[model samples]
Target chain A: MNSHLILRTVSKFLIPLIVVYGLYVHFHGDFGPGGGFQAGVIVAAAVVLYALIFGLDACKVAVPPSWIRIGMTTGVLLYVGTGVVTWLLGGAFLDYDVLRNNPDHPAGQHLGIILVELGVLFTVATVMVAIFYAFGSRTPDISDEDW
Target chain B: MLNLINAAAAQAGNVPPTLIIDICLMAMLVVVAFAIVRIRSLFAIVMLQGVYSLLSAAWFVSLDAVDVAFTESAVGAGISTVLMLSAMLLTDRKSAPVPVKKALGPLMVCVLAGAAMFYAIPDMPAFGDPDSPANTGPGMEYMTASVKQVEVPNVVTAVLASYRGYDTMAETVVIFMAGLGVLLLLGLNGNAGFWQAKVQGQNICTQAAPRARILTSPSDKPNTEPRAPGDPEPSSKNTSVKKVAAKKTAARKTAAKKPATKRTTSKKAAKKPAKPKGEAS
Candidate 1:
């Protein structure tokens, strides 16, 4: 097969692996060298790879640029929302201890981490695709008629 | 030499791998930035800029600043580079590398900033010492307590959204404002009519400049529909021919309409039959 076909085929398999690894890093961050940010980028890279094989139009059809921007905003909002939730519970901005007055429960931390990571993933992935389209659509200056 | 050796011996404490990586990444970052700035080709510069951002991300990662790394790599390397290249496409190529003529001002500012940041670091915890104030402070206390109250595990999330709820709200508002500004500047709602004209122009040029035959003369195929007419086609030969042909056709049509002038001359020549008769004699 030609390189384009090969790359497309390979990317299909590669994206899943990247996403899985991203989740693994995100969840296992406390014990390892990865976290929400790393995981988000890894997943975003998978989407970006998809954009590379397909044209910007095809990629937009799959994942609209507007949706990507929304996703980015959503991630930030989600991250901020978690803090707001904690603050409403009578805790200082992010004092989770005051969230329920229970210091031993890991559930709050788990919930917060998952939401934040999801947000990061959304922002990172969408931005990645946006940039890909921006660069790919560039018009070359090879034409000299204007000159 | 003896005093230097003793000082070195005293400083042989085990350094964290993160610190080592940070130092090494910083050096690599400098080299990559130099290469990017020095590169002549626009294409090469774009690629190098990507490398520079990636290196910066790696540096942030080494410092355990995951969020900053994510933003830098994703936005800086991925999107910003694309935007820059897209802007570059509308311009020239093979220009000389942008020269650094006024380095003294920037260098001084950089040195001042570096010194300030360095001075600030000493008052902060010494690179991930678990016993540092940050680990024992209310931030840490809040994280431990958050497990009970909020049932959340990620302290960073709790700190960013809840602990700094007001900040998050302000940030959201700021982003919304920025988005609104962008919409005002490039929105389809108000500027549709303006951009439509530009789109038509671009379309004509694009149609005229066949993607498959970009390098060849356009005169070879005069029947092809232009992608965008108002926009100039970049090919040199085809445009000139099209212009010349258009002028020639117009001139021919005007000349054809004035057949009366030519007929008058022919009629005068017909009356001069003696001219031929004299020649014959």
Candidate 2:
């Protein structure tokens, strides 16, 4: 098989698996060692690999810059929104127990963990992609004029 | 005394496997650092810099700082490498090889500082002592309590956003300033008319929107006349004729409006006779 086709086929299956593993690591952090940051990087790494094997242009077609910007903003908003919700419910910022009427329930911890992990994933993935664009993209003016 | 020194050497050689591996990695790091400095080729030096980041990530992993290791691998190995590559493309890829310079004053200062740090480490907590005063500090208490009370599983986020939120805000402001600086350097704000003139001339986006019809006729009318290279083509003449026809149509519409308005006033006067007779009846 050609390299591009092979990469396409592999990424089709690989990205979802990486995302699932990232979510597992994110949720399992309280019991195990891995957490939001690690999960975020893992998922971002998988996407970066996809970008590397395929051309940057093709990679961009798959996930455009606008979508990445939105994802990053959504992640930060989710984290902030959770805090605001807790604050509104008569608790300090990020106080998880205030998410529900029942303070003793473990559901708040679950909800808080999921939201923070999603935010971490969003920020890490977008920043990775943005930095990639910064260094990889060359203006035609700069590129055409050989230094 | 000779026997005692030999025995000590033998015991050192029998150090645990993990310690041996750590020593090996440290030695490799030293070799990489020396190579980075001594290498004459700029291209090779840039590649070695990326290698250095990967090695550092490995060290973090060995130290059980997985989060830090992941960040280093992604940012250092990935992002920094891309940045260095871009910089390399912008300039000449060769370095002038010079003999090693004399390192007298700064080298001595660095060595002395390193020695002082080594001396200070002995008074700090032993490798992994859980009950050490350093480990039992209020920071540790905060970390433990924050996990249960703050509700976020990621203590880093809690500490960064809630406990030390002001610092995060300041960092964000710095990032915003940097973005603004980049925009200023790129001249995005200068000569607002530059984009306006280009847009008005081309009308590319105007065609996409319904409201942009205001920009269509006048601008496109003159510009599209020269599209045909040869007048021998029948379609070219027909299109030019169509343009003339459109201008005639516009003139006729303007001409027709005044007469239509006058006709309406005359029609109203004619209708007054019918209205008066109906009122009399």
Candidate 3:
């Protein structure tokens, strides 16, 4: 696949753009349609596309599966940690209004939402990639001729 | 021309464009569903499922559920397709023949579920009705206050990440658990592990590069060593040989500089008939 000039060129061109779009969707989620889940899936799709074109070995080198596992754990921890922070601040669990000094301010909510969405993004993307890796790692039970 | 078109669209009324798009998408979805049900090939079914997701995504956009549409398009159409294809790589492409009697029970269950859903539909309020229980109550309060409270333009995100944060957190945990389940079931062999070791001539655990090279090189050229009497028939050997040859050609095309010894180990592994069958089952 590396030697396939057309595929290599097109994927090289497209992958960065897809990744950028994923980020854009993630950040702009507050103002628009997309958010963590959609952005995560889109980003995972970009990685999957890279794996498909460049082969799984090359992809593993680029984004190690161990890192993906860590990311999956970290995202959930981030989400839970945010809640714990809110609790420490003397608010109810996941109550963003009390995250900052002023309970009535919207700025705290904004910060809280961003952090939570980021957590969601990380977990969703890494979990998706992990699932892809799991499936790709297995050898086929049946041969192509059997198909 | 723009004015004329605008006038024509205005004359056609609010329903035409949305109705047309809705009908087209729904009709296509129905067709794809039928095609999926009728298809025997698992590969085609997977492709059709992707199409189904895309169609539903379009429908979600039409319904003004852009966030839902975005999620559907990315997760349903994109990631799911790739995941399913990866899964198919390890499994048979053809679905097994099913007896009518075996399928009947599931069919009845589906029909009953569908009927119950249909029975409940009329009792539900009309779509977007402001006075509806959903649109009134807390939902209306959220819509009114979310902008001022969350300061996010997209209410869905605000609600999902903040207002209903606990639910979203649980959902994230569910996804995390799902990934954990797959890892536990399949084992963490995604890296340069046993599968890649077979094809790439690199020991996953030991990282014994030189030994891998030696093992791979000899395995490539025809094994002059006498075969054991208990070995399987020559036909299986031929199939393994053909597969190795094909893999070699592919590797050569893509990675000319890579050592030819890479695929030989996999060929030898494939020849061990009992191992793969036992693992698969």
- Scored by DockQ, the top model is 3
- Candidate 2, residues B132-186: lDDT per residue as tens digits? 9867887797778876666556566556545654454344334334433433332
Please provide, for model 1 over B116-189, each residue's C-alpha lDDT reduced to its tens digit, 9 standing for 90 to 100: 99999878867678889877778778868655554445555555544554564565455445444444443311
RMSD of 3: 9.5
What are the per-residue Cα lDDT tens digits for candidate 3 across B97-170?
A: 76566688889999999999999999988767878987778988888889788889899998899889999999
Native contact fraction of candidate 1?
0.14
Model 1, position B96, has a per-residue lDDT of 72
lDDT of 3 by residue, A22-77 (tens): 99998998899888888888888888988888866567678877778889999999
Ranking by TM-score: 3, 2, 1
Instruction: List fnat per candidate, in order.
Output: 0.14, 0.10, 0.73
Model 1 spans with C-alpha error above 4 angstroms: A1-5, A19-44, A64-147, B1-20, B66-95, B98-125, B129-138, B169-281
Looking at model 2 chain B, report the run of 10 residues with the lowest lDDT sum: B207-216
Of the candidates shown, which would achieve the greatest TM-score relative to the real structure? Answer: 3
- Candidates 1 and 2 compared: the better one by DockQ is 1
lDDT, candidates in the order shown:
0.55, 0.57, 0.74
- Residue B198 lDDT in model 1? 56
